[model samples]
Target: MANGLDFFSIGGADAHDGARAVHAWHVIRWLLCGWSLLVIPAFYGELTSTSQGALTIARSLYLCMFAGFALCLLWMLHTSRKPKAWLAHNRLDVTIMIGAAFSAGWGAPPWQTVEWVLRLLFVGLVAIRIVLSLKVFFAPNRLIGLLIAGAGVLAMAGAGFLWLEPRVHNYADGLWLAFESSATVGYGDIAPTTPASRVFAVFVVLLGYGMLSLVFASIAAAFIGKEERALRHEMHRDIKHLNAEIVQLRAELHALRESLTPSSDAITDAEALHSVPRDHH
Candidate 1:
C-alpha cells in the first residue's frame, strides 16, 4: 500500500538489520502456520465427540493461532513508517484476513445454516489476496472464478437442502426454497408457499444476483493506464540506474589494474627483454 516512507531511512538506524529482524519474526510466524496445519485437523475432528470442556480447549487453541497471526501484522505496522492513508488501506486487508481466520477457527451457528456465510467470506479473502498479489488483468477477464464459484455454491446449498430436508422437515426446506426462488425457478415438489419462506426467497434473489454482478460484471473494463504504467516505467528507471552503476564499477576496476601495473624502470632489464619487443625495435 504506498510502501510506507522507507521507515528505516527516517529512523537513522541500520535498515538491513531491521529488515533481518522482520525476517526472523516472519520465520516464527510461519512456524506457527506449520503448527496450525498440523493440529487444526485434529481439533476439527474432535468437534463432534468432544464435550464443552474439550470444545473450550479446541477453541482456545484456534483463537491463539489467529491472535499470533494478528501479532505479526501489528509488528509489520510498527516497522512501517507510512502515512495514515497507507496504513488505513493496508489494515483493512490485515483485519479481514485475521477476522476470517478467527471465524474459521471458532465462530458458528448450526454450521449447516451459517456455513455458507463462512465459506463465502473465507473464499472472498482468498480472492482478494490473489488479486492483490497478481495485480494483473486476466481481463476483458477481470475475474470469473469467484463468481462462478459463488453461484455454484449457492446452487449446491439449494440442492443439498432439497435432498436432506424431508427427513427432519424443518429449516432445511426453507433454505432450499430460498435459493430455488432466488434463481427464479422453483419446483412444486418442494413448496415454500409460506410468507416467511417467500420473504427469504426475495432476499436471496436480491443478494445472489447483486453479489454475482459485483464480482464478474467488470471483466471487460480492465485497462492498465497511467498510474500502473508509471509503476512499470519506474521499474525500467531502476534497471537503467543499476546498469550505470555496473559500468562505473567496471571502469573503477580497470583503473585499479592500471594503477597496479609496473613502470618501465620497475621491470627488470632481463624480464623486459624477454617480453615481446616493439615493432620499431
Candidate 2:
C-alpha cells in the first residue's frame, strides 16, 4: 500500500487550465468505476441465463472497458516527467493489468474455471482501483466498509463452492464451513475432504486474513486520527483564548499604571503656582 502522504505529492501542471483539465480527466476516469461496478454484477447475473452469444458480447464489452482504463493509466505513466512518482502512483494498477493478462493467457484447468477467474480479476481490480482513485472522497470508515463488503463477496464464493461440492451436506453447512475456514477459527466440525475443497479453503483463509487486517487497521487509524485532530484543534483554541486574555490583562495593567501616575498637566500647574508664590514672598 502506498503511504497516504504520497498521494499529495502529485502536484498540478503549470498551465492555468492544466489543473482543470486533469480534474475533468479524473472525473471521466471515475466514471469507469460506476461502469465496472454495474456491468460486472450484471455480467455475473446474466452468466447462467444468457446464451453463449450474449455472454461473449458482454465479455467483449467488459474487455473493451478494461482496456480503455488500462490505456488511460498507461498514458498517464508515460507522460509523467517524474518516473518514480508515476511508478509509485500506478504500480498497483500495472500489477492488476499484468495479473489479468497472465490469468487470461496462461491459466490452466477448464475453460469455465478460467473464465470465472477472469471475472473475479475484473471485479476485484476495478473495485480496488475505484477505492484508491476516490480515496479522498471516501472516509476511512467507508473504506473499511468496502473491505468488509469484499470479504463478504469472498465468503459468498466460498459458500457457493462448498455447497456445490458433493461432499458438503447442505447450504447451511457450506456457509458455516466457509465462515469458519475464512476466519481461521478451524472449528474442524466441517472439513474439506477433497483436494479441490482444501485448495478453496486456502484461498478463503488468505483473503479472509487480508481483509480482516485491512479493516481493523483502517478503523483504528481513522478513530485515532480523528481524536488527534480534535485534540489539536481544542489546544489551538485554548491557546488563542489564553493569548487574548493575556493581551486584555496587559491593556488593563497599562490603564491602571497610567491612572496611578501623577498627571503631567497637574504637576506643571502646581510648579507654576509655587513659582508665583515665591515672587510674592
Candidate 3:
C-alpha cells in the first residue's frame, strides 16, 4: 500500500501526475485487499493441517501474495515521476518484501525461522493497510466499516484459537474464549493452555483492545457531532429571529420620525404668524 502521508498529494501540480498517483493508489489498495483475502485462508489452512496438499496450497497463496506486493511496488515506481522519493517513502514495504522473498528462497533451518518472522511482519503490514484503507475509502460510514473489520479480525482470531487451544474443543467455545480474553473478562473459563495458544491469546487481547477502544471513540464522536449540529441549528434560528426583530424596529422608528416632522413644522408656523400680527397692531 502507498504511504498514508502520500495519499494527501493525490491532487498534485500536474493533472497527469495526479491521475497517475490516483491510479497507483487504487491499484495498490486493491492488490493489498486481494493479498489479505488470500493470506487469511492460507494462514488458516496451514494452522489447521500439516498435510502436503494443504501446505502446497498455502505456499502457492503466499507466493501469489508476494507477487502482488511486487507488482504494486512496480506500478508505483513506473507511475511516479519521483522514483527516488517513492522508494524513500516506501522503505518499510521494500524491506518487508525483500525479507519475504529471501526467507522463501533460503533452505536452511535458520532461514525457516526467518520465514516465520517475515510472515508475522507481513501480517502486521496487511493489518495496518486494512485499517488505513477502511478509514480513507469508507468515509461515509467509517465507524460501521471499522466495527465490521474489528469483528472480522476477532472472528479469525477465534478460529485460530480453535486450532491452537486444546481447551477450545468447539468453534463456539473458541469464540467465547476469544471474546473473554479480548474483553479482559477472563471469566475463569476456557483459558488457553498451550504456549502457542497463550501467545495467540496475547495478540488477540491487544488487537481487540485497540479496535474496541476505536469503536467506543467513534460512537462518542458521533453523539458529540449530533449535539453540535443541533446547537448550531438553534443558534442560527435565534440569530434569524433577532435579525427580523431589528429590521422591524428600524422600520417603525423611520415611520415615527416621518410622522412627527410635519406636525412640529405646523406648530412653529402658527407661533410665527401670531407673533407677527401682534407686532403689526
Candidate 4:
C-alpha cells in the first residue's frame, strides 16, 4: 500500500521548495484579487463627465488590471501541479473576462449601459468566486475578519449610494441605511426618497442578496469540504495500518509454517528406516 500510494508527501527539501512556491502563488493571487476590487470604484468614478484623456486612462487601467488577473489565472492553470483544482478555482474569473470582452464590443459608448452591466457581472462573479475558491478569505477561525470585510464592502456601497442619493445626510447615516437595506431591516427612519436612490437601492438589494447567498453557500461548502478531506485522510491512515498489520501477520504465518514443517534430513532418515532390504532380513 505504501508503494501504491502516490499522493504528495510532506518531507525533505523538495517539500519545503513546494511550500514556498505555493506561498508565492497565494500572494500573487491575493494581490490580483485586491487589484480587481478597485475596478468597481474606478468604473463608477468614470461615470462623471471627466476629461476624455482621464476616461481613456481609467478604462485602460481597468482593462489592464482585469487582463493581468486573467493572465495570472491562465498561468496558474498552465503551471499548476494540480491543473484540475486550479481550473475549478479560477474558471469563473476567466469566464467573466471573456463575457466582458464580448460585451465591450457590442455598441457605441462602450462604457455606458453595457459597461454598467459588465461591471455588475464582474462584481457578482468575483464575489461568488471569492466565496467559493478562497477559503482563506472567509476562514471560520477568523470570524472577525469576515465581519470586517463585509462591513468594508457595506461601507463602500453606502458611500457610493450616498453620492447618488440626495437624502442621506452623512456617511454614517448612509452606512446605516445600507446595512438596514441589506439586512432587510428597512427601518422607517431612513429610506431612499429620490429616484436615483431608489434605483441604487434596487441594485443594492439584489447585490446584497446575491452576496449573502454566496457567503452562506461558501461556508457550507468549506465545512463539508473540510469534513470530506478529514474523512479521506483518516481512511488512508486506517488503510495503511491495516495493510501493515496484514503484512506482519503474513510474515508471522510464514515463520510458523516453517517451524511446523519436518526437517529434510529427518524426512530422509524416516524414509530409509521404513525401507526394508529385499528378502535379506
Best by lDDT: 3
Task: Kindly list the per-residue Cα lDDT of model 2 for residues 150-236, writing each as its tens digit.
Answer: 657566855655544556777767877777877799977778775346545765677677566666777888789899999999999
Clashes of each: 1, 0, 0, 0
Identify the runs in model 3 with alpha carbons over 4 angstroms from their true place: 1-16, 36-57, 106-119, 137-150, 245-281
State residue 272's C-alpha deviation in candidate 1, in Å: 77
The collision pairs in model 2 are none
* lDDT at position 264, candidate 2: 91
Expressed as tens digits, the lDDT of each residue in 1-26 for candidate 4 is: 33322211211112233564465566
Model 4 stretches with alpha carbons more than 4 Å out: 1-24, 49-54, 81-89, 99-119, 133-135, 139-143, 188-281
Give the 10-residue window scoring lowest on summed lDDT in candidate 2.
Answer: 8-17
Give all TM-scores, in the order shown: 0.32, 0.53, 0.68, 0.52
- Please tell me which predicted candidate would have the highest TM-score against the true structure: 3
- Top-down lDDT ranking: 3, 4, 2, 1
lDDT of 1 by residue, 1-281 (tens): 34654321112112344664446445544443343342323234233323666556655655665666567556655664542433454454454446546654664423564764654454344334433332333233445755665556576546534433443265456565656655667676575443323333444565566555645455433354455778899999999999999999999999999899987777887587889667874
TM-score winner between candidates 2 and 3: 3
Ranking of predictions according to TM-score: 3, 2, 4, 1
RMSD of each: 15.4, 7.6, 6.3, 9.8
TM-score for model 4?
0.52
Candidate 4 clash figure, as a count: 0
